[model samples]
Target: MAKKRNQVRRCVKKYIPYELHPDDFLQTMTKIFCYSRWFGVAGSGNLVWKIFGILILLLLAIIEGVAIWRVIKALAGWAVDIIGHRSVTARLAGTMFYASSIVTLILSWKLSSSWDELAAFWASVDQTMAINVPPDKNLKNRMISVTFIIMACVILEHTMCMMSQIGFDCPASLILKRYTLMSHGFLLLRTDYSIWFAIPLLFLSKVATILWNYQDTLIVTVSMGLTSRYYRLNNFVAKFSVAVKKDLSRNKQSNSLNSRNEYTWRKIREAYVKQAMLVRRVDAWLGGLILLSSLVNFYFICLQLFLGITQGLSGSFIKRLYYLVSLVWLCVRVSCVVLAAADINVQSKRALRYLYACDAHCYNIEVERLQNQLSKEYIALTGMGFFSLNRSILLKVRKDMAGAVITYELVLIQFDDNGTTAHIPSQSNATF
Candidate 1:
């Protein structure tokens, strides 16, 4: 087991880059977006590629819009049929799935528009790290590892969903089914449109799906990056505190040492301020996307659970497996986003304990300022100025989702029972 673990670690280290600067944290994602033509205006591409990217973005917008309309139309038709609980739940799930595509498009557009500002923000962060934080290989490896893990999860989930929709079959129908599934039923809605159109539509659908998953991954990546800086800052303070204590105990403290410690404390305070400002800028840019992601994740989680409870036993084995995997994956992804953002808050306050641990001789005005700044200011990502993302919110969301699923299950049971009795005639009406 130990040997296997070591081999696995080596493989991971070999694949993931060793020297990842903070500014290049999103390089992989940028390449993906550029290739998919989802990020044209702000992407690093030639003039022709940029124009082609714009066209691709426009096409995606149209496709997603049409898909949303088709879903609404399908939902209306389903309501008319009024089959059962299963139909309603299935339709609702599909609606949310397609609706998410539009949301992803909006996020992608916003990111593209704000690319210049974001680039500047990253540059500023890299500059700060260069000046204050010493290079640490372990930190770089950890950040890249986190990013790779999240990306892997998303890609795996997408592949599974696609496979579930289009299982191994004959080559002729396989192409048809692949495009049909990607269309989200748009192709079916308008039979007059040639099947050939499904080719481009299918490609656009794949890109939209990438954007949908990438939004959350980006948030987690940026949060982890910010958290790393805070971790480094806290580590520095911890070491300084230890040094101060040792010097005092040995009765070797001197004016020169005191002066140096004071200067270090000042630099630490300045770095904190800069990081805090960067966090705010990031929040301003990503707050809307975060808000949308949280709400979308919450809705789908509940929807998936409701479907599982309603159809788990009656559904086919493959369907049960799909729902099980989807629910678990959704939960894991949301947790990554929430916990990663919350960690920023956790690491920021951690320095306070070390600051308080400093000896009297080592303590200075700068230390007090940092303490006040950290203690008094609440630093964490928020949902478009509405709610903050933290541990408390995560717990509350879990509790609420549980309550919601239970309530929905009970209501469904009652609904079905009443529906069954409504068809039966009274005995008086059946007299012979």
Candidate 2:
């Protein structure tokens, strides 16, 4: 008993140093297992790993199901047409969205199955722990390398697709592009975060599978490779950004700051200033909704990272909330694109109240003819261009602007009529 206790003490001393916090050992032993938190996911030693593997399968299935459901819901809606009214762009966007969703679902299913199989294999290996075993270092190394290569290639391909679809050349395009890229990037980042968590869990599971697997060398190598890849990618992105910034700075430096800058720059600056003010208004109105989402995502990322290291499952609620927020945003953006497309034939009517008898008669005749010809002419002018997916997205933005305008108008009306309370639209519910 004394020797056994000494061995345990030595083992704890040897193993516990890798923990970020000294208390992580205690936390790991006592804190709820994430798998166990979901009933039936934990069982006897072998079965636990098996069940854990199955849980992973279930998770992937759920994600795929949710993705499919979202795509189907996106397709089933009149919102797409009604909101993007008369837009060919909106229709194209609808098609693109459906295609993207299908592709993602398929990719996710394939990846999930691979992961499940790996987990099951490890679980099976663990079930026979009493038998003599060999290291099989070459096989293990190859497996790890293949797993990483597959993940890296898939991730790179997805990132390139995102860059092609969403990345733009200029500042104006960057606004929409940035959001699109970030949204998709966030999805990838979220997946990576899951991978980070799973790695440690798989390491522990492997330990339970065999004494040889408990050797830290393999885990360290795998982790180092992944970390190196991530760091290299991040550095590359940073350098690209630096290059762009340098070019912009050089361009600005080349131009005279005072003379041409004032004339050309002032006019352009004024236009942008006005636009900035309008954008600020929109952003201000959206602050509560989007800010909440950003905050939740921030929390999830931090908490998940912490949990991944500590073998704890804190902040899952926040993660789910973040996902829910993402879902909502996705729906809103899609709906907006559709609405904008459907609005292609929309126009304004004006009433002129001027006294000129002959001019009035000519105007009346021309106006009548114009009104009669308006639909065909307007339809021809807008065509599929107005129906374009981007335009549909723009129209959704216009709807938001319209709502803001309506809110301001209502406030003014209330102020004028009552000299009391002024109304503002609830920012929480406002959508673009």
Candidate 3:
């Protein structure tokens, strides 16, 4: 039996490309997502696992719903007290945080629902590129490294935020109390909640945090994978261009060789088409996620900057440290997500450079077709058809954020100059 098994393994290895195996491609990410219950493994026939995944998702949904409800209730209370309280910043930040959490949870549910289509997309991408482009030798290591970095950053940020809230000077009992309240999303509720309730909410909050960070990590990882494929394709074209130049210079070009070059170009073109289609599929799957992530990141960044400028070294040491670390971390993470997605568009267009440089002898109908396809197609991820993710977006977002911060600062300065505070009007104060 062992001999027969070995023989079968050898036969399969000999005939099938390693990249064709869906399990091997993005294996680390697949494992992480599956373990988190955000996605199920493709082709799995385990009934119990599927049921368990469903239950886990349902539980998370219920928890998130409760958390959101609590946030809304807190917002209503704040609205009533807005005239007397100057805690606008805290309220806004908390609201944005919970709103972003809700968005991340929804994206997670979407991913779980579309796992089969996602699996098929991966399979198609692998089959398209496996024939000519060799797999990246360090892909697994790279993925693992990315996962590690994302996890470390998230864990550090969460810990620091929690500690900042609890304060370093507090006694153990007080610290524990504060931690429970914060984790249970009851800090803003201003009411005592049961320990039993807090414990479960704490666990659910941790899970929610994981899902939030994992969503961005997943986007970055998948973007890296797609960008690498396009890069490989571009490299192949470059090398082939070099060979074509050499043949033309040596006067060794012949009819058969020209035909072969054309055939290669045709194959590359077909692969390019497949890649573009795969990107569209990916965009469809992740567009809502990207849109929500961008909005949430933008809002928080603006809010953080506003708070940092207005507060400015006035808070506790731990609070100051948390603010600085979180701002830097958020900027780095957001930049990574944006640039990673943008590179897909950049890499897709890069092939055009090589195609244009092809030797005259090698240029043919296939070459022209490929050039046209590359030039005409605006292949990039989008925010649910609202906006394209590209280099320009980064610049635009930065500009807008700066403008927003400046405008907010001006408003505060005007309020201070008038010697009166800006406050939300109470119901009794309404004129109409």
Q: Which candidate tops TM-score? A: 3
Writing each residue's lDDT as its tens digit, candidate 3 over 1-432 gives 676545544533422356453344456656656665533221232677667555555666665465455446544564333221123333334344545555676576667557667867777666755235666767677877888888887777777777766777779866655666443332333365666666655665565566567678778887888887888788877877887678667765465456556656777788899889889988998888898888777766765676567656555787677667878888888889999999999999998888887767777999999999999999999989999989898889877888988886675444333212211111000000
* Candidate 3 regions with alpha-carbon error over 4 angstroms: 1-23, 38-89, 128-131, 182-191, 251-253, 406-432
lDDT of each: 0.61, 0.30, 0.65
Clashing pairs in 1: none
Identify the runs in model 2 with alpha carbons over 4 angstroms from their true place.
1-77, 80-135, 176-432
Prediction 1 global C-alpha lDDT: 0.61
Query: lDDT per residue, candidate 1, 59-137, as tens digits?
Result: 7666546545544654566423323322333334444554565566566566756666776776666565422454444
Candidate 2 residue lDDT tens string, 1-432: 676545544433321223221222112212222223232223222555556545554544444353344335434552232121112222222223323222332322232234334334333322322211222324334445543553453344333333333334447634443433233221222224344433433332222212111111122222232222223222332342343345445564433322222232222223222322332332232223222322222232222222223323223454334333433543443343233322322211111111121122123343333334332332211211322222344455546544554454453333222212110010011111
Q: List the residue pairs that clash in candidate 3.
A: none
lDDT of 2 at 211: 15
Candidate order (TM-score)? 3, 1, 2
